[model samples]
Target: MTEPAPELVRGELTRELARAAVAARTGVLRVTGEPGGDLHVVHGLVVTVDSPGAPGVRALLARPGRTSTGVADLRVVAMMAAVDGCFAMASGWIGGCHWQDAPEAAGRPEEAMPPVPGVEPGWLLLETERRLGALAHGRVSPHRNHLLLTERGRAMLSGPGSGSRREILLWANGRRSCRDISMLLCRSLYAVTVEVVRMLDDDLLAIAPVTPDPPIPEPVRGIGRSLLPRRRRGASGINDTLPPRPPQPARGQRTLTPRRTERTT
Candidate 1:
C-alpha cells in the first residue's frame, strides 16, 4: 500500500484527538474545596462515538501505554478507560457532526449529542497533557468541537456562583471583553456581558475605554449653555447674555432673577 498520510502515520490527528478528548475531561476544570476553586462555567460536551467513528476516536486516546495495541484495538482500551472512570463517556454523534456530551444531550433528540462535563480525572487526560501539552498552551477553543474539555476541564467553570456580584467583577477585570472573559471564566457569551455591566454600575468593576472618547459635540455644549435664559444686559457686567439665577432655590422651587446688564450669553 502507498505510504500513509503524514498526519495519520505520525499520529498528528491522533494527537489532536487525544488532546481534545483530554480537554473534554479536563477543560472545564472543576476543583471543588480549594481556595478560589469553583465551577464557573463549562464549554465541554459529552461525546458518543458511533461504532466505527467512536472506535477510531477511542483508539487514539488509548494508543499509548498499551503493549500490544493496534489502531483497531485502541477503542477497546478507551472503553476500558471509560469503564474504569477514565473518560466521562463514550460519545455518539447524533447528527450534523456535533459531538454532544451525555449530560448536555438531554431534551435534544436531533443534532449531535452535546459534549458532557467530567469532574473526575482520567489517565488518558493526564497522558494527553503530558504528551500533548502543546495543545493546551493557548486559550481554550472558540469553536464548538475545538473547545472540548475532559472531567477536569469542566471544573474550571466553577467560579463566582450564579448571579453573584463577584462573578461579574471577575469578568469585568481590567475591562476584559465579554467574549474573552467568558472564555476565561468558562461562561456563555450572554451571561458574561449582562453580569459584567451590572457589576460595573456597582463599582465592583471599572468602565474602561477601548479608545479615547470622541471630542465633545459643540452643539451639545452650546445647548447646555442655552439651557439658562440669556442674561439681560445690566451694570453687573458678567458678560451676561443669560438671566442671573439665585443660589440654592427652595426644594422644588425655581427663582429667575433679572439678568445684570453686564452679563452676556
Candidate 2:
C-alpha cells in the first residue's frame, strides 16, 4: 500500500494524526515547532506523547506521594499525559511534522511505566480542541500570560482549599504563568489553565502586567573618535597658524603713543 508523505503542514498535525490512526499505521510522528514533540503510535492508536511544554506521565507518577501500582492507575495516568501533551502542542505554534516507521519494541523500554491501552487519535484531537475552546472562553493563554494572586486569594489560601489550588497560589507571584505552575507541580497544563481562569473570574487571580525588557544602552564613543568632523591639522588653515593679538591698552587710552627713536649720526 502507498503511504502518505512524512511531511505535514503546521495546522494539519492533528488531522494527520487522525488519518494515521484510521489507517492503522505504526511509527513515530515527530512534530516540529516552538515546543514540538513526538507522538508514538502503535497500530492506529497513540501509545504515548512527549512534549516539553507539558509534564509527562513519568513526572506525574514520580511525585512524592503518587504511589499507585495498579494497571488501572497506570492507564489513567498515561491517558492524562497523552491528552495533556496533545493540548500543549496544539496550544503553541506547530511548524510541521515527520513520520518514521519503527517496530513497537523500539519504544517499549522508553516507557516510564508498563504499557497501557492507547488512545484514538481522533478522540485525542477532539479533546484537545475542547481544551483550546475552554482556554479561549477563559481569555487566558496558558503559555504566554503570567499570573499573580490577588489580596483575596492570599486570605483564602490561609483558610482552606485543595492542595493543588494552594500550590498554584503559592507559585503565582506575578512571575510564573499557568504552564510554569503546571510544570512545577507536575499537574496538567489544561487543568492549571482552567483553574487559573476560574480564579480570575472569582477575582482571586489577576494577569500580571508584562514588564517590558530593559532598553539596551547605546555604545560609548572614545574621546577623540567622535563622529563630528576633525579639526584641520596642517598649514594653510585659517585659524591654525594665527598669532595671538596684543593686549589692548587700559580703558582711558584710545591709542598707543609712538616711542621716540634717537638716530645716531
Candidate 3:
C-alpha cells in the first residue's frame, strides 16, 4: 500500500513555528516550500537558505577576502539569506512542502555554515512582511487587473521622463497586460502596475469603458400600486380612527323597520 501523502505546510503556520522557536531560544526550525528550497533556523538566526531558483546569500552580499571573514560577517550574510528565503517562501515560488521541529531536521550542516547573529524571530517575520509590502507598492496594483496604454502614455516615453518611468512608458502599448509588461521588462507585475496606475491617475493613460449610460426606469403605475394590500390601523386588526357604523342590510333584504313611534298622548 502507498504511504499517506505528507501534510502540506502553509507559509503562515511555518512562520508561526519560527516565532515559537525564536521565543524558546533553543529549537531548530525547518521550512520547506516551493519554488523549491529549504530554510534552516537555529536559536532565532537563519543558517542556510538553499534555493537554486534565487540568488543565495553570497550573491546578495558582496564577499570580502579572507581577512574580513569574521563571525559578524557570517551572521549578517546568514541573516540576509534567511530573509531572502522567507520572501521566496511567502511568495509561493516553491511548491507546497512540509516542516518539522525535530532536532535532526534542524541539524547544522557538516560544512561550516555562515554564522548568524542572534535575531528575534518576530523581527524576521515583520521584516519579511515589510519587504513584501514594499515589493507590492513598487510593482503590484490594487485597483487594476489589466494594463492598456493610451496615446498620452506612448508620448511620454519620448518626452521628458527619466529612468524607470521612461522605461515603463516606452514599454506600454495598450495591448500588453501588467504581467506581460513585467515579463518583458524583467520587473515585477506589481511594480509595473503601480506605475501604470499612477500614469492613469495622472491622465497619462486612459482605460475607462466607452459604453453608454443605462436607460432610466419608468415611474411606477396605478396597476403596480393596486397590487399592494390596503393596511388597517388598530390594535384589534381594524381601523379604529373612524367610528363603527351599523352593518348594511343584504341585497334585496330589508332590516327590521323601526316600529312606528307610538303617538305619545
lDDT (Cα, tens digit) per residue for candidate 3, span 1-265 = 0111112233554555566575654344444544456555555455566553344655545432323457676666667666655554554433444555535434656433334554555566666566555544333332233455567666666677566777666655555555455445544333555576677767666554435689999987777757887765565645556778879999999779878877877
Least lDDT summed over 10 consecutive residues: which range in candidate 3?
Answer: 1-10
Candidate 2 C-alpha lDDT tens digits along 139-202 = 6777777898899999978886756678888899898888888999988888888888888998
- Per-candidate clashes, comma-separated: 71, 0, 14
Candidate with top TM-score is: 2
> Each prediction's Cα lDDT score?
0.34, 0.79, 0.53
TM agreement with the true structure for every prediction: 0.20, 0.72, 0.39
Q: Which of the predicted structures, 1 or 3, would earn the higher lDDT when compared with the native?
A: 3
Better of 2 and 3 by TM-score: 2
Order the candidates by TM-score, highest first: 2, 3, 1
lDDT, model 2, position 140: 73
Best by lDDT: 2
Q: Write down the TM-score for model 1.
A: 0.20
